[model samples]
Target chain A: MQRMADYISVDDGLVDCEVYSAAVYERELESVFGRSWLFLGHEGQLVRRGDYVTTWMGETPVIVLRSMDDVVRAYLNTCATRQVTLLPYDAGHAEVIVCPAHRLGHDTTGSPVSGQAVEPGHECLVPVARVETYGKLIFGCLSDDSPTLRESLGDATWYLDNYLLRENIGGLQLVPGVQRYTMPGNWKLLAENFAGDDYHVAITHASVLAVRAQGIEPRLNNSPGKGVGANLSVATGFQTGVPHGFLEVRIGEEFFEHDLMRAQSIGPEAAEWVRTRRDAVDQNLPDLAVKPYSFHVANLFPTLSIIGNGTSMEAVGLLVWHPRGPHQTSVTQLCLVDAGAPPALQRQMVWALTHQQSAAGVFAPDDHENFERLAENTRTFEARRVPFNYEMGLSGEGVDVRPPEWQDPRWPGLVLPRFTEMIQRDFYRYWRSLMDR
Target chain B: MVDMELTAAATAFLNEEAALLDDHLLDGWLGLLCNDVRYVMPSTAIMPAEAADARERRNALRWGSFGDDDRDMHFWLYDEDYSSLNMRVRRLDTGMAHAELPESMTNHVVSNVIAGQDPLDSELIRVRSKFMVHVVRHENNENTFVGSRWDKLRRTDDGLRLAWRYIELAHPVLPRTISIFF
Candidate 1:
């Protein structure tokens, strides 16, 4: 069973280790996701003890809670006897999390506070499989074998420091409110697409192209920001593997470039402001050789992906659901970075995103219909030989920029190949090694 | 606590305004409003009790006519002329070209029609009306939005214009950008 011969073939898809395959979506009671060091909420999100927010940790639904001591904690989402989630309310601070149906009561730390109809102690925020954080991003795991959140992120922390963390960067915060939508497709497809894909921009996001044409997209795009050099343009090519062209943090009149530096050198304050944060981030992303890009649209693995436009105004999260066995996927986009940015920046981000590719954007309707039909087409036959063309940058991009681990090279763009036959090749390489053992 | 004739007039006036929005008739809607029609859609924010008391339940987040000329750039609406209104209407047809699906299909229902009996201004009627608006939009899917509107109306020789209107939402954070007027 440890061999993982039964389910995954990263070459086919992420080779599902039998351990994980058995749990892909096993029932809530049995799934290991609930037990893994799942993502709860960010530390910045819960500043006070009573503050609490609910999040699903794989199959183990749970909540990251806060209490009187001002320390944050985790609690089981399930009621004592009933199967329903206990703290269903959106977000609020409170002394106790009580499930009305089961009458199970526990304090924020998930310990028995009181009020369980039982003869005695059944209260406690069932301990998480694990809990940890990198900068502001928090993770909770339910399984014993899965590594700590830091390890779970493995090497992604380096990319995060620039976007988050205050030490050397602009203060980062998530503007509240979620944007959501449902599409019909496999959840994994969306993740791969977000992880790294610049080929789709000209084709799929034609509407965004139109927006850029209309003078909305500030950074010059359709090509690599710096063409191929940070010396030529460090702050220039701060590219994110946007499904479309590139994600450049557009503040006003355009200042910083993709490499997280000023396009033109700056005053002591602005220069220090830009370089320190950029250096901190570069230190984290060990693979980039030098400054890796600052555009932080990340795949929190599994299903969630977010990208910070890195501009004060631009930040959004896409929570995509592509349930297996179903021919559809749900893509929810929440503009979570607007916790009171400057009025102008807010207007620009709101205008550019909402007006272009969002659910109602000119481009979304097209993409939605395309993805829907594509999913339906896949169902027509088994092993239909669905060919994804990741060949766009492949012609010249194959050279190893970083070698052994990656080929990003002096290349100006594309984070890494996340999916596709090529990415599948990378996946199988990793999965096969794991299974071979 | 107002008179009936003025109430009837205000109701008709509000209905006319809705027709304009429903029809995407930006010009007609603007023409019907006061030149100084204070159009501001301020999102509600949760604040500390002390802050709330200082403002007397009134805030910049609260949309109204500006009601004050010194602070009012009230003349901009008409000063722009029908060309501006045309631009707005065309922008809507552009389907949120200015804001992309920014405007939801809101059913602005103004009721509880009340008009003042005492005439303060020559032709102006102190009218108050209660309103409820429902907006539905299809983003990745379908979203239903609901809210209430408070309007203070003043009658003109031609018709009633919204001197001020305040929208209070049951949900403070709007789902997304609402480009269309309610």
Candidate 2:
């Protein structure tokens, strides 16, 4: 196995293909994902007592549940003795966790309540390191030494809360089952793509935009910004704030107005709600300076991504790039709606997400196919010899731009223009630090 | 009574549609749909055998607790009206759709075609067929989609046109994507 040092160079933007190597992947399973605060599931998934949902912490099976005592807890889903998976379903409610094999039963708190030939105080399921929440989002850490979720999120919280926490609404709640599918790609590729990889959209998603344009002729006139080029020119002056590497691209007033038209189609009440929220944001958070074609493909470190739509108000739900192997990733897509959003708005949000981001959706298909090809190409001997270019909009040494005055004091991180490659650079450096540690 | 002649005609129509899709004749396939056709493929979900009841599944979907959306304005794999289908067909036909940049080689094998008069509309015939769509791309990547389709065909003065179609994918987790239609 190669040392972690061979994986990347922060100076020249040289990232070794070892990042997708099985050896490096093994090390990451221990050093990276093992210690990081990983997104588990939202609190809405386990609202009622005895509610539980099954998920993964890297390759380890985990169960996140709302206990009979009304507290949220997570535990390794394997039975202690034979290591059999305790939870058979992805999600369900049960008074007691039971292992189908050998008939070992555990209480909601993961304590061994019933089992034959067992020692005293022996639990069938091992509890995870920590279970914490930021608003309704639940996250778990496998190692106790990992920083708290808020601390781990750091300055990115400001941008996260902007769409997560609404004034009139409480927080975003995940809508039903998460859309999941596997694709041939490294998990990190997904992380990099989502976290400020806007450059690929115009090319990778050209067909989708073209298709959408054909759907309605007026859409051509209703471009998100003056155009991509104009938006980048304006964003360059905005400057990068800190090295948090989080990005938020906001749309112009016309985008919201277009959404307002869609909301009006839903109903009058929904239209009023959209109008009120739009006006409130415009008046209250004037410093944000909502621009045309603004959207955020914000990544929270290792795996979780929060995608904010340019046209809509709330952030698109969580997108988890769960690594099954070096070349395999299982994607989990969740849709979140504002708690206070009317049913009509909720429906609209869900439909919008389904059409745009879901597995069968137009946009996601474009990305996944490309990622699959990337994984194939990168693994080849010829491609690994040369480093991929991340030099766009960066100085000779790859530092992002400074933050604008309006966002200076409030937002933190290596604030850069929306179109810069600095955000992805910061992500890789952060990843290297974690792996090295 | 099961009319053999009508059944033969319905089977021929279904085969013709499949051939159109395989030949990348999207416009030809689209032409078979009536003006107000509704093509829907509900998002598939993996639920425990106990939660397999239609009512229970619908309830979970309604509450946004389990599965994908119920056939409301909720999440769906494909919930297209006529105009939407037009857009989809138009997009696929365009050379720019990167997903189908070089269209995947497809062979749509259809069988078990059962046709009968529609109970709701006398002019409409209900047809059910099982299909297995084998799609190969780049000579290396390939997938087989096994599903059943329920289509409503209305007898027009010229010919029969598909008024409604509901495709049910058997697998809870699709192999990769349902990028191409079922």
Candidate 3:
């Protein structure tokens, strides 16, 4: 295996395909996933004491739980000594975590208790190095040396604030469960797609957009039709403009009124709450203002992404691109709503999530087909030789000139014009930096 | 109580529906539904079995087993009403639903069909059946989905029309894309 120095061959804006290779996948399991802050679960999943959910921190399975004191903690789902996986299912609230392997049991804090022939102070379940949160989104890191979640997130938090920490809808609550599915694809392909691949929307997902043009917006009707468009032209981020990009879907003033009516039909209070919060954010954060009907989609570093319908900030659509193997990815989705929102509205959010995102969603199939084919084609010897071009808006007439305002010290990271590959390029650069370390 | 004749008729209708799906006759299948028809498949989640409360919560989110309450809280794979189903069919008609580029060859195997009078509405009949869909895409990639369906059939002038259906998949993680109806 080549060291980090020769791992990538940058030819202009093209980078070597070794980043998606099987061997490098293993190294990433070590260098990237192992030492990076990974999204574990949302805090709302653990409202009650003993509420826990099993997730992957890299390839290693870990159980994150809220303790009796309400402090969240994470521990490897395997028995410390036997290494036998303790939990088999996704999530739940349990009084004690008992390993069926040896009858070993541990409290929420990973302290060993009564178990078959287990001695005290001999260790219980192995604890994950760190557990942290940002806007009710819980994250875990396996390596102690990893940066703090806030530090790692950096400018990405700015985008999260627009959706997650909006004034009235500050705390987003993940609904009770998750929707998970797998695809025959490399994980990075999906990650890059979420990061900033606006160019593929018109071509790769043309059919999805074509279906949306049929006119039955699912957000308004609670149906299976497309609700959002993919005309992603302008966006903002802390680095580039906030860490948020807008999908260029123009719903005229009449449609916006119709959308408001539909939102009221779902839940008047929730609709009013979202409207007030959205207006406040738009008014307060002038730089972060986006078009009313434009979808807000942003990827937070490694894999956690939030995509929403431009209508309201009520539903928080979360997707985690989990690396199962070199050739397979497990995509998990969670749609969250405010805890205080009406149950009917929460259900509507969940319903809207199904219509728009998720593995079984209308939009997902479009992106999945691309990622699956991209993964398959890249594995070929011929495809590996050709570098993937990300040279758009790099220079000349189409260069993404950085606006003068983003140069202010208030905005973090390198800023560039919207619709450029800068965000994705920055993604890889951060990835390369992590892998190199 | 439903007589064997009613059961036989329901079984035949299901069989014909399966054949229409296999033949990719979406319009024909759509024609069998009433205006208020709801075709839904609930999203499946894996809950820790060791925790009974968790399991109960998860199951509560899921569609109750056949004959239980029809109301469900879990997100759906396809919670399509008539208009949505119509839109979906129209999408396929456009021949632009790229996921079906080389249109998949599918076989819908339906079994364990039981028919009875609806407890709440005598005019509607309740039919419970299990289905296994064998989908072959690109002549190589094959996927099998096993699930149970509860259908509320209402007698219409045209014949017994499907009023509502709840398809609950037994698997937690589904095959890549469910681009076609079950």
**lDDT by residue (tens digit), candidate 3, A1-437:** 66644645322456677778888898999888888788888777888998888888777888989987779999898887778888887887877888887787887787777776556557668888898887777898889986787777766565456535553445566554467787777787677677677677667656656666767655534212344322333333333221333333232344355456666766778677556655665665666323333344667667777776444523667888889888788877887765655666666676667766666666677676666566667778898789778776656222333445334444333434445665565556557766776
After the best TM-score superposition of candidate 2, give how far the Cα of residue B24 lies from its true spot, in angstroms. Answer: 0.7
Model 1, span A297-401: residue lDDT tens: 445444556654444333444443324433444443444433333333333344444433454444455555455545544444343343333343333333322
**lDDT, model 3:** 0.68
A best-first ranking of the candidates according to their lDDT comes to 2, 3, 1
Q: What's the ranking of the predictions by DockQ, best on top?
A: 3, 2, 1
Worst 10 residues of 1 chain A by lDDT: A231-240
DockQ, model 2, C-alpha based? 0.48
The candidate that wins on TM-score is: 2
The local distance difference test score of each candidate is 0.46, 0.70, 0.68
Q: Which scores greater on TM-score, model 1 or model 2?
A: 2
How many residue pairs clash in all the candidates, one count each? 48, 22, 5
**Which residue ranges in model 2 land beyond 4 Å of their true spot?**
A215-223, A227-248, A265-267, A279-294, A313-315, A396-407, B1-7, B50-73
Interface RMSD (Å) of model 2?
A: 2.3
Instruction: Highest lDDT: give the candidate number.
Output: 2
Per-residue C-alpha lDDT of model 2 across residues B58-152, encoded as one tens digit per residue: 54332223333333544467767677677667766667777786788899999988888876679888887899999887758888988888788
- lDDT (Cα, tens digit) per residue for candidate 3, span B23-117: 98989999998997877786776764447775675443333243223244554678778987877677667766667776778899999888888
